[model samples]
Target: MSVARTLFRLTLLAGALSPGLAHAAGLDGSQLSLLWALPFAGLLLSIALFPIVAPEVWHHHFGKISLGWALAFLLPCALWLDPATAGGVVVHAMVDEYLPFIVLLFALYTISGGILITGNLHGSPVLNTGLLALGAACASLMGTTGAAMLLIRPLLRANDNRRHNVHVVVFFIFLVGNIGGGLTPIGDPPLFLGFLKGVSFAWTFSNMLLPVLTACLILLVVFYLLDSHYYRKEGVLPRDPTPDNARLGIQGVFNFALLAGVVGAVLMSGMWQPGLDLNVLGVKVGIQNLLRDGILLTLAGASLALTPTTLRDANEFNWGPIAEVGKLFAAIFITMAPAIAILRAGPQGDLAALVALVSSADGSPINPMYFWLTGSLSSFLDNAPTYLVFFNLASGDATQMMTEYSATLLAISAGAVFMGANSYIGNAPNFMIKAIAEQRGVPMPGFFGYMGWAWVFLFPLFVLLTLVFFR
Candidate 1:
């Protein structure tokens, strides 16, 4: 093993043992400078080493490079820090506090439009837009992953006849799989962390509506125009509305019931807090007792019992999505812990100066703008940690000196979560969608290529959102 990889793994091992100890120790200017330099050096080293790691790992897992860069700098920080701080950060991240919301959102997503119980409205010009709208709405309910799996195959089939069809897949990823998930805690993981941190769950819904709607509306228009251009170029004649296939009938009302049961169990799990006191069996138990011994066991049972076979037909159920999401996000969940710790140490002078420039003297300008830009970057990084870093800075309690800042800290939180879907890597589902698409034999663009599409399509929508809401 090279020196860099050895150091990298050791850092992760230390972080797993103890988290965030380095930052709390108060590194001096020179030490902080060295810390700052590590990410860049690590990024370069990882890129250089990526090709040599393993042939199949490179071919099958190369998309993980974006995540690799995030952990490189983080692991080193953890290794060098105090054990207490590092342990706390690592434990807090690992506890899966957001798993209940993840389960609920996924349940709703798969059950709603994802189950495809109603079937696609045949021959409608609005088919694509309607699906996108449904997708966006579902995202806030089911999460991007759930909604993406439920709809992607049908959407791809809907456009299967078109010869020049790359844009449809690209836009599907941009909207349904990613940006749509930004509106609610259920929509994405990063926002769920915000909710757990004390941001009201309902506040995100109202705050992100305008931006979500604007992006959906614009993307719908662009999708129409692009789909039309491709439709024309291929000279693909439109088919008259086909007869409805009632054979693929709704056999899953019970599955829906089971799905709801699973959701309820998850929500109930959230109410119990670790280390709080409770009395049971003539013995006093902490909240952790209920959560670990009682709630988790119940959750496992509900999930197992709620497993419905109707999904086999209703959504053309396959394990591919489950496998894909599991593999990519598992890597993200494990590797990105260190990255979150380093950012938690707070910004350095250059970063602080950059943030000041981004935030206006009016305070309002910088907050929303930072919300969008940070959100855009968050898509490529593991968005949860990226969201935390920006959330800390934007809500850093330093707003006393600024002017014209009327929005609450919650709105900043909303903006970061809502806008995280601007690229493939912005959130976990985005990459999962890409991976599943490729696995199913759909040719897709490389990382930079996908971003090119986002730059053209999403950037304008973001600008419009800023004009309408943030301004």
Candidate 2:
């Protein structure tokens, strides 16, 4: 069925299921039972398991599956609560959160896809490490998705002649696709969502600079050592694919200006708020935010119009990744409404015990727990919403989070961004990078197999970070 038709049917079903419950101002999470979370749990399991067990079916029908789960929650919600309230929640999730989230990602994905890195360099340990470092550095400047898409092919080409090249891609996902994006709001969706919620654009840079540097440096050093060890074991360097005299260059350089425009637009939204706003179904949408989204869409369009089609073809740009993210996160935002509302209820809600996990016996916020919980869930669930859950759990007030509870906010931010390297599904870019590598014959690990690498390499580092910084 068409997406519009499906949505229309779901709305009609919700209206039919309404049981004449009085109009509620909003969800009363304190009165909600844990049973309301079953659909959310089901969605999570579908995401985690379906691809591995049924790849073809998943690729074809994942959107339908997502819509199914959303309806599972929505139908019951409309029956048990006010239909208007439930409809309002759906509108809020779409307008206030999901639309902007997907638009920013779509813009970055499109603009970055237009720029292709041409030529190849030898995959010597030093060269590989240097490339990874460059990608990591560019991640925050352009975005994890943008940097990963721009560099992954070149990196894969550089190492294509090697036998033991899986580790290189793994670390690329670790550094460039995840941790490196922690430094700015524009760097990752989670941080961008934080920006939309009123966190300063510079707050992530200011607070996460040290942790991001420390993590990237450690990962780079370890990657170099491992790559060097493998290089020596290979005994003979394979014949170079590109001409030895071939030089590295870039195509579609105009997209770089477009990327800068995207950054400028985001900054303008945050810094140039004009106090004019539009309320759509009780969710406030600021004029500046609308302007920012418009500029981003325009920049993406300009990239497509200005950049040569040959460049995009060389980059192998496709809409699949962005489409997948939109479908899954659409379900995520809708199904997760009760969960987020329950979390926002704090000590009075059904999730009080979960909330208490991040606090101390004396009622103080526990920074390490916040780091671990946020990071752990982010490792498996989508990090953007995981960050939002914790952000609301701690204190939703952005000013307070930036000031009085700065350390706690820091812990939350670090956990969400840094620990996303723990698994392929941790961040959107991780899976994209892995898929590109596999297509280029890099043979990345399977889901659980990848986690084995993370367990040995990243887990210990996170434990250290918790003790040294979060504690």
Candidate 3:
């Protein structure tokens, strides 16, 4: 028999034999059991066989393998709805749930002129580090993707003369792609998801400033040392020593204004509006429906129309990153269909179990350890769901304490979104950043190699943040 067929058969056999796989929940459970166990077991076998059979395919596709494993493990539990009910569930997930995130990301990307960076340059390492820190700070307000786009071209330009300046790109990912977006809903997708779920909108910004400031401080210091070391070794000086066109230029102030409008629109979405009260021309309409759907759609359309010449200035403006995001979201949207159903089936109970396992509450307020641990895991699972799960669990009463504890809760949510950059697969932009960088010929570290950077440099600081702030 062919190897693919043989592997498939073995996977089926493994599913039949494994008690854990066999014991999920319902019909969905049984289907999940078969798919998760066999293909997963088959994948392990394929990994073992790769050296002899197809090392090239294995080397290039292990990232896909990792993603597949995540889908297999999570989808079974996620997709517990009856097949008959799944059609409507999927429509809702795509239209109502996932669409807003894509619109937000796309609008942010376009408004920033879609500049992705991937080369080395020569300049003052101190200046470059400062720029990166500044770039990150800008991300919370401008959107992480927006800040990334705005700074990436200049950062690449600054480092254009040196081979040793790769760390600059990694630090850019750490800050702009992840850490910088902690302060506001516009800064990151997961937080926006929180805003949609009844977490106060304005509360995110007020509560998250401490951690945001702390991350910026750490990144600025570390980036300076690393950047300076490389700058000296490579002797990369600016090609154009002239001061003209050297300063940061605001090419489109109007775009910035509209961008601010989008943030307001997102924040307004958090307002709780009871359905059916307002009248436009004596016609009664639901305020809740308008806030949920209307605000995001308006912002998305406004972003596209905000600029007159941004698309022209940016050149062809390929949709590669957005396309990749769409693919991943589709896969996720479909695969996770069952998962949300299972969670929603009894969110309170599931959340309680998760909290019990991860947290120890102290008197009135739920302590930081539970929040941090739960946040960390959220990075791997769907962060949106993870955030909701913990939020629902901890804030069951959601009294003044929940509102009072908003800062801590926001810190926890930000931790999950920010530290997600620690691993390539931890967040969407991590991989997108890596792919974009590699495509442009800047060498990025391996998955394990990148983890070394995070472990040696980033994780300790994060732990410190948890203790000092969240704790």
What's each prediction's TM-score?
0.70, 0.88, 0.71
Candidate 3 residue-wise lDDT, 122-210, digit = tens: 35777788778888888888777777766765666565556775787888888988888888877877787676665555677777777
Q: Which ten residues in a row have the lowest lDDT in candidate 2?
A: 15-24
Off by over 4 Å in 1: 1-93, 96-125, 237-248, 261-321, 330-339, 347-350, 358-365, 396-411
**lDDT ranking from best candidate downward:** 2, 3, 1
Against the true structure, candidate 1 has what lDDT? Answer: 0.54
- Which lDDT tens digits does candidate 1 get at residues 76-128? 64577554443333333333322332344344334433244444343233676
Clashes of 3: 12
TM-score of 1: 0.70
Top TM-score model: 2
lDDT tens string, model 2, 153-209?
A: 788888889999999999998999998988998788789879878898678798899
Sliding window of 10 residues with minimal summed lDDT for model 3: 22-31
RMSD in Å for model 3 = 8.7
Error of 1 at 403 (Å): 14
| Better lDDT candidate (2, 3) | 2
Q: Please report, in order, the local distance difference test score of every candidate based on alpha carbons.
A: 0.54, 0.82, 0.58
Arrange candidates by TM-score, highest first: which order? 2, 3, 1
